[model samples]
Target: MNNNAYNINIFSGGAELLFDNKRHYNIDLPNKDTWKLGDLLIWLRDNLLSERPELFIQNNSVRPGILVLVNDSDWELMVSSDLWYLICSLCQILCKYAPCP
Candidate 1:
């Protein structure tokens, strides 16, 4: 593995159906120091998301009704002053979308 590259696991809960029903992904992200949660979100949208990108992303962040957990911690609690949290190696990211009423 490249020095700048690190592995991460992504889990899609209720949102798996939108990603062709695939619930898990083992991703190797290239670039470590420069990567942030915001960047990861964009990367996921452009590279992994199969459909309904709008439902998952809005204003450069996840839309309402969707929960993003980083390393088992709520993303909101991890956000920094700029709202972009630095991503660490071997972290787990879980994206869960609440069912519509």
Candidate 2:
């Protein structure tokens, strides 16, 4: 399961997880051969867009919470957001695999 094809550029690094600068984390990951495009839309709908009545209509959309955009388009509006997610997921999944300093 070597995932050398992907890497994520974080907006920040360190404990604060800030969002105004650039940072990066690289790790070996498994290939995303098992994922599909539909998975990305579902994740956006479940994790970002779906709204509760308590929130405003505009706020209901995940449009605001998107921390980053890959290749200019948001994953929610792509032919295969899953591909992006797969790459990003690899970042999360392999985070613990980092070598200790």
Name the top TM-score candidate. 1
Give lDDT: candidate 2, residue 69: 45
Candidate maximizing lDDT: 1
> Residue 65 in model 1: shift from native, Å?
0.9
- Tell me the tens digit of each residue's lDDT in model 1 across 1-101: 55434344455667776676787777766655678888988888888888989988998788898888888888888775558887776667888888688
Q: After the best TM-score superposition of candidate 1, give how far the Cα of residue 42 lies from its true spot, in angstroms.
A: 0.6
List model 2 lDDT by residue over 4-101, tens digit each.
43344443222112212224544333355644333433332343333341221234332233333454444554434333354334432111111125
Reference-based TM-score of each model: 0.84, 0.33
Residue 97 C-alpha lDDT in model 2: 11
- Candidate 2 local lDDT, residue 15: 11
